[model samples]
Target: MYAWAARWRNAQRPKDQRLRDAERSGRPPDQRDQITQKLTALMSTTPTAHGYRHPNWTTPLLVAHLAREHQLEVSARTVRRALHGLGYRWKRPRFVLSRRDPNLRQAKGSSRGD
Candidate 1:
């Protein structure tokens, strides 16, 4: 295949040249450490502090905030992956009425004498 041919050709190159990859230009890899540090700092505060309506941080919201404030454009999935790599876990808060409040709504709706 062409790959084998290219490998053989590359083998014939000077040792110094073969040791280094050919020069190329394109977007580089994401800065995981920077993202992690940002996330850690951001997590210490509520989203409202950053002018977000929601109090908690979501992947999409994080992505948007990073793009708008930090000028770092990345996908929600990227943020999610970074969070996972940082050992962050996501948990949804549960809202429920207390067991002693079962009839609290009815009592509040009815008059004290009735």
Candidate 2:
């Protein structure tokens, strides 16, 4: 608590000498606006059109596609993060019983002893 108070007081000192967050030193922020736009556009279309054998875009598949098409080398995790940042979400394909026997319900009902 005392240390925190001292640090707070120091931060409140003269503006020039005041404590401030240190400049971040590392790989610069990934600003891939063009890539994000292309990704979103790709999402709007079927993956098949983009030469992907499958119809949906998985993170790994997207990563590979971006590398092949845009020459961008990125990880599947990075692709997923970028997609989420772009307000996109992953969706699983929904499966429904396409063909059902008309008498299936009746047959099940008759099979139940109760």
Candidate models: Cα lDDT each = 0.83, 0.78
Q: How accurate is candidate 1 locally (lDDT)?
A: 0.83
Deviation in Å, model 2, residue 70 alpha carbon: 0.5
lDDT of 2 by residue, 25-99 (tens): 989777487678778888889888877699688888888888888888888888888899999878788987788
* Candidate 2 lDDT for residue 47: 86
Q: Write the per-residue lDDT of candidate 1 for residues 1-114, one digit (tens) a residue.
A: 676556557867775565555689879776788888899899899899999899689998999999998888888888999899888888896787667865555556658766
Local lDDT at 35 for model 2: 70
TM-score, every prediction: 0.61, 0.57
Among these predictions, the greatest lDDT belongs to 1
- Number of clashes found in candidate 2: 0
Positional deviation of 103 in candidate 1, in angstroms? Answer: 16
